[model samples]
Target: MYCPPAFREEELPALHDLMRAVRLANVVTSGTSGLHASPLPLFLDETDGPYGALYGHLARANEQWKDTPTGEALAIFMGSDAYVTPSWYASKKEHGKVVPTWNYTVVQARGPIEFFEDEGRLRGVVERLTSLHEAGRPEIWSVSDAPEKFIKGQLRGIVGLRLAITSLEGKRKMSQNRSAADRAGVAAGLSASARPGERLAAAEIPQG
Candidate 1:
């Protein structure tokens, strides 16, 4: 994460919010074989540690777990990203120097990676994950809804992971480097775009 001072977000609450809101994250690790990446729905627990902890699970057959990592793992969470056209920049009119860029929020977490296959831990991770995603649904289905034997059997095919985040880098690139008129133009453009994600990002650009 190459972030300048103006674009850096040092607020833990904001980082945690981004993580939770973007439940789908990319977990990357480097092993003797090289870099390995997996997209997983990881949840952040901010109650402990200087940074926090991440929890998720992958299919037991995934070979990513077999490759031993030399150190901590990296997880990337992305939120509200949109493409910004130079046509929206006031600077473009002045000298045509502006270029296209992205406006978004991102968090990079590095932590000790621990993988487990214990039935209880796997069940706990999967249950909480299910509950978290299902919280807003009108009809809620729980782990107990299924027979114990069946649920236990299902857990055998998955592996759980816990990563204690040692370092967290957060960035919010919301046109902070652009002129006010340019930012306003971008906001107007994004606010009217067909994509809801662009509209959400439009609302985040600072008015200054």
Candidate 2:
């Protein structure tokens, strides 16, 4: 994440918010075979360590769990993102110097990756993940909803992951680099976009 000072977001609460809001993250690791990345729904336990710990599962057959990483693993989470057109900039009328860019919020977490197959730990992780995602549903579901034998059989097909976060990097580019008028134009353009993501991003940009 090449974040300029204006776009850097180092506050812990903000970083955690971004990670938690974006439950699905891309976990990347480098092994002897090269680099491998997997898109996984991860749960962040802020109280687990200084930075925090990430929990999730990988399919039992996933080679990513089998390969020992050469270094730390990286988990990337992305928030609302939108394309900004040069035509949305006020300066474009005076001088066509503006170019298209993307506005987005993202976080990168780096840590040592650990994979486990312990039934108890795997069960705990699965239960927690399910509850987290189903917290507000009208008909809540739980691991206990299934028969013990069936649940155990299902768990056998997966491997658990724990990444003790050592560091975190976060960035939010929301037209802050643009002039006030340009930013307002950007906000208007995004708010009128048909894409839901663009409308979400409009709220992040400043208004004149």
Candidate 3:
């Protein structure tokens, strides 16, 4: 991520918060064949390591797990984002120098990747991931809710992955580079937008 100093978010807790908020991540790896990527819903275990560990599963048929990865794998988690129009910038009226840009938050985790087929570990991963997303639901579902034999058969069709994070990069481009007046304008504009994403992004902009 090409992040300027004003937009860089290096705090570990903040990075983890972004990762936890975004359920899906794009897991990318480079192999002899080439680069392969999969969009997987990953759960973060902050206590696993210094930077933390990510757990997810890939379909057994997905070739990404078969190839030997050349280096550390990357997991990209994207958070709230919105389009910022120059019309929302006070500078646009003052000097007409402002151009449109995007405001968003994202976190990238790089780590050594491990793929396993152990049934017990796979079941644990599945259950943990399920619980994370289903926590606030009216009716929660569990792996035990299904027949054991059926669940076992379902697990056989997938492989579990654990990425022990080595490093984390976070970027929060919420118009931090803009003047205070311009930022306030952007926040106001986004807060009034009908798009839910835009409204969510409005809260991320720094008031100071």
lDDT of each: 0.90, 0.94, 0.94
Which ten contiguous residues of candidate 1 have the minimum total lDDT?
62-71
Worst 10 residues of 2 by lDDT: 62-71
Q: Identify the runs in model 1 with alpha carbons over 4 angstroms from their true place.
A: none
RMSD of each: 1.4, 1.2, 1.1
| Cα lDDT tens digits for candidate 2, 1-208 | 7889999999999999999999689999988778889999999999999999999999999888888654699999999999999999999999999889999999999999899999999999999999999999999999999999999999999999999999999999999889999999999999999999899899999766
Q: Write the per-residue lDDT of candidate 1 for residues 1-208, one digit (tens) a residue.
A: 7999999998888888888889799999887788889999988778758888999999888888888554789999988899999988878889998789998999999988989998888888998899999998999999999999999888988899998999889999999888899989999999999999999999999997
Q: Estimate the TM-score of every prediction.
A: 0.95, 0.96, 0.97
lDDT of 2: 0.94
Candidate 1 global lDDT: 0.90
Instruction: Kindly indicate the candidate among 2 and 3 with the higher TM-score.
Output: 3
